[model samples]
Target: MTRTAAIIGGGVIGGGWAARFLLNGWDVKICDPDPEAQRKIGEVLANARRSLPGLSDVALPEEGTLSFHADLSEAVAGATWIQESVPERLELKHKVFAQIQAACAPEAVIGSSTSGFKPSELQQGAARPAQIVVAHPFNPVYLLPLVELVTAEQEVAERAAQILTGIGMLPLFLRKEIDAHVADRLLEAVWREALWLVKDGIATTEEIDNAIRYGFGLRWAQMGLFETYRIAGGEAGMKHFMAQFGPALKWPWTKLTDVPDFTDELVDLIAGQSDEQSGAHTIRELERIRDTNLVAILRALKGQGWGAGALLTDHDKRVRAATALAARAVDGVTPGEPILTQARAVPLDWTDYNGHMNEARYLDAFSMATDRFMEFIGCDADYIAAGGSYFTAETHIQYVDEVHAGARIEVKTQMLLGAGKKLQLFHWMYAGERLLATAEHFLLHVSLETRRPSEPGPEVAEGLRLVAEAQADMPYPEGAGRTIRRPG
Candidate 1:
């Protein structure tokens, strides 16, 4: 069945929610009263289009078209899920829900992106409370995977969970309807502590952020608070850690439940502090930095299969490999038969002469094949980063047939010669087994730090020797065996 999502409100959060659904291939309908809503949503979509693909391990799901509606009733008419991200006003929420109820299907779930409002409070006296649930997501919803779900109805909660899980999110069902939900309550605790730190002149805003990010945040990356403390508890465990630190709770340290007075002076001071912390960069630059850091952190977690790892893993499942190389391993293939690399599509930027793939793209495709070949020989990034790099010394190319833009091409690499210090590689590009181009090259191992020719480490050498021995009986391309060329 085709899935569709309706988002009410075109604010930052609404736009983000729309992006999340749209990128996951859900058709989105947004209703907002703001005159500039379309422009604002478009801008958000532009950024999302660029960043979402990078966050995805595979190509994104089919993108959904975004439509705007002036009428709330019109927007939710046929949506599978209705997300209301209106301004956090009780009366406004009530009005929207009343209108939404009239338009949305009885089976479709209605979710509010309300940060602090409980479902009980929002659904007070409504004709149908079970259909309405809190689907509160953090800011920058397109990147963050956490969504707090508050609902009394098991069916509604389960349905919401299914939708959220489908889109690669961690939807935690709150056992009870709390004032601020789980994540926000934790955030409130941190916010209060941050305010106290600034009010007491103990640290600047940046200092507090640095203190958390550099210290505890790094620990939290792999292990949450309880887990970290459990480790600190040593062999004794959580009981010991709690017993040792529990006494600190008795001290006059914090007003955790107390809300700070929203005085003008205090607001000004905090605003000034925020400006001081952020004045150096524009919003776009800040977003770029945030996305880059998120990508790095998520990529790191991909290895550990932690917090954001689930999303990355889900992305990998949906990603279709452009080439067949990833489908199977070349582990024991005899050397004479070409080792098939993955199928690849010509990128939009690689088109040139005669509206076909530029001659250089064939080389690029061969280069990727070389990387896979290196990985097969156990010469991965860590090895290269640790003072070892491969230097291509020679190349011969024959463009037998033209490949146009968007065409899928495959490469088959054959080893001409594999010996200590030098290995000759020959690659052929094919459009479904029809030869399109051929490249023959020679590569030498080099010490990256010294940039000088060097023999690969024994482990790498042994691995290559195994591959070479296996391929020994295979016939090489007629002109495959060639002299190793030296780079100038």
Candidate 2:
């Protein structure tokens, strides 16, 4: 059964929440009085659709339905998750909570996307205070996995965490709620220091941004604060580093506790500097740029299986399992037929200057297909870890058509020969019915310990025997043995 999520505001954050849930196969109902809510949310959703699916190697679930409602009650009618992303006004939040609780299911998770307000403050005089929790997400909620879940009720927090994880979000359950929650408090300190820097003419907006992006920001992205400092301690650990640098905390190195006057001069100065720095691109362009960079960073992290990338890896496993279950339910895999190995969207990074998929990505996609095929034939990670694996010896690729970023692509693999230490396969890549490319790969089963060709494990050999026997009568794929030829 498809779950339903109600977005109580259709602005950037609300639209992002809607996109996240909807893309994860939850029907979404948006409630916002703004006449432009539909357009705004549509724009956000468009960015999401182009970027989010590409984050995973496996294809995401089919998107659920999206609808807008002017009436709060109608929107929250069947919603299992209701996210409140209204402007940060205590009175306004109370009013919205009252309205949401009145209409929404008592069991529905009421998540507030408030950066500063505590759950206690939000739950004040609510119909069901326990149902309300803080689920503050960063901007571009579709891509970022972190959601600070703050609540006093452990049951509600646990339920919310499960629901958020289903939608590819990391719910960091807070033990106790404070004025500004964890991340924002840290961010506020940085913001305050940046402002002082600007106010003192020590750095411009761009310089401050550059200082972070080009410097410690990269370290912070992967290792975070304490771990990075721990490394900085060199032979010693965090204790040594802290003992050396901890005393600097009392020095006048930062104006974090101070605030610049809220004067128009400061505002104008900051805005003017910001415009000078990034006035060339529109907000949409900037958002796309940010998303693209984030995708690249996260994908890189995924390769290493660290930090947020580990979360993505976990999500991909879930996606693969779910996809396999769905496929099995529909039409069980037939042995003789080509196996559907890979189904995914072309990531933004796969494109080049030509605006279509770079030629190299063809092999990359085929490589993933090959990996999937190996798994199907029982030569998975565990098998490799146990000193048995296949190494690609030769490959031939034919690019029949061009595919662009965000295009849904699938790879079907057929076993040509699977016996002894030899494994030959053909892969056909497609976008819908259009043939995008084809690759023929020849591989050798090897022993990782001795680093030489070796007889396959019993299970792997059996799997290969079954597939080869089933596909014995199958016709050879066209252009299977072809090689590069000069233009006629």
Candidate 3:
């Protein structure tokens, strides 16, 4: 059954939450008072569609239904998960939550995306306070995996964490409530430093951003502050490093003790600098640029299977198992419609200097398609782990046309041969109906224990036979046996 989520606000953060759920195949209903809420959310979704699926080689679930609601109660009705992302005002959130509680399922979770207000404050004068949890997600929530989960109730927190994990998020549950939570507390410290730097003219906004992104930000992406510091400790380890640097806390290198007033002059100075720096790009344009860079970095991490990349990998695996293919899970052998071997948007990072997909990514796409086809043939993860799997013996790719970034592409597989130790397949890559590339993959079944070619299990063999028979009547694909030539 399709799960339902109700989002109480439609701003940047709320829209991000919606994307995380909706793109992951959870039916989402949003309540926001803004007249432009639909348009705003549409813009966010557009960027999300272009970026999120690129993080994984596997295709994401078919997106869930989205609807806008004018009434908060109507939005919360029948929702399995209710998230309140109204403005940061405590009174406003309490009012919204009251209406949400009146209509929500008794066991449904109520989450507040209030970065500033603690849960204790939000639950004041509210109905269902015990169910209200602080579920703060960062901006661009669909791409970033970290979620700060804070609630007084243990079971509530655990259940919330599980739901977040299902959607490919890493929820950090705080043992107790604190204003601003953990990440924000640390971020607030650095944010104060950056503000002071700009106020003092020590650095411009762009320069300060460059300092972090070009330096420790990369380290911090994989390792949090303390772990990075531990590595800095080198041969001595964290204790020695802390002992050596502990005294630096008193150096007053930061303006954390007091924040600069948001006076007219200071505001003008910051605004002027920002305008001179990045005013040319619209918010939507900047979002795409930010999302593109984020997708590239996350994909790189996914390759390492560490940090955010691991989150993405988990997301992709669940994505395959949750939606379209869920009914045909490995345990059940019933064949359904030919599963989509690949359905993805060309990420901006995949483009070369010439602004088309790099020559190599075409093969990458084909290889992932081959993975999906393997899953369909019943020789997937489980079969491989049991000591038998197919190995790619040779690959031939023919690029017929250019594929650009943001293009939605799909791949269709044709079984050339699937019997005994030989498993040959062909995939045609398409940007909509236009075929842009064709790839032929020849594979050999191998026994991992013996390190030699071997016949697959009967189940796998039967599965392959079905696919081969299904496509046997189809005409042979063009460019099957063709090789490169000076003149043809």
Best by TM-score: 2
Please provide, for model 3 over 1-488, each residue's C-alpha lDDT reduced to its tens digit, 9 standing for 90 to 100: 89999998899999999999999999999999899999999999999999999887888888999999998888988998988888888777877888888888879999888887888898888767889999999989999998899988998888899899989999998988999999998998889889989999999998898688646786666545654565455455444555567566567877764545555575456445544554565545544655566677878878988766787889987886764533322443333333468888898888999999998999999998998888877877898999998899889898899989999998878777877898888789999889999988888899999989999998788887777656656776678766422111
Worst 10 residues of 3 by lDDT: 328-337
Cα lDDT for residue 462, candidate 2: 77
lDDT of each: 0.79, 0.85, 0.81
lDDT of 2 by residue, 222-314 (tens): 546754564455544444565577667666888653544535565456445545654565555554665687778878878988766787889
lDDT of 3 at 485: 20
**Candidate 2: lDDT of 241?**
60
Q: Deviation in angstroms for 458 in model 1? A: 40
Better of 2 and 3 by TM-score: 2
Q: Number of the top candidate by lDDT?
A: 2
Clash totals, every prediction: 6, 0, 0
For every candidate structure, what is the RMSD over all alpha carbons to the true structure, in angstroms?
18.1, 20.0, 20.1
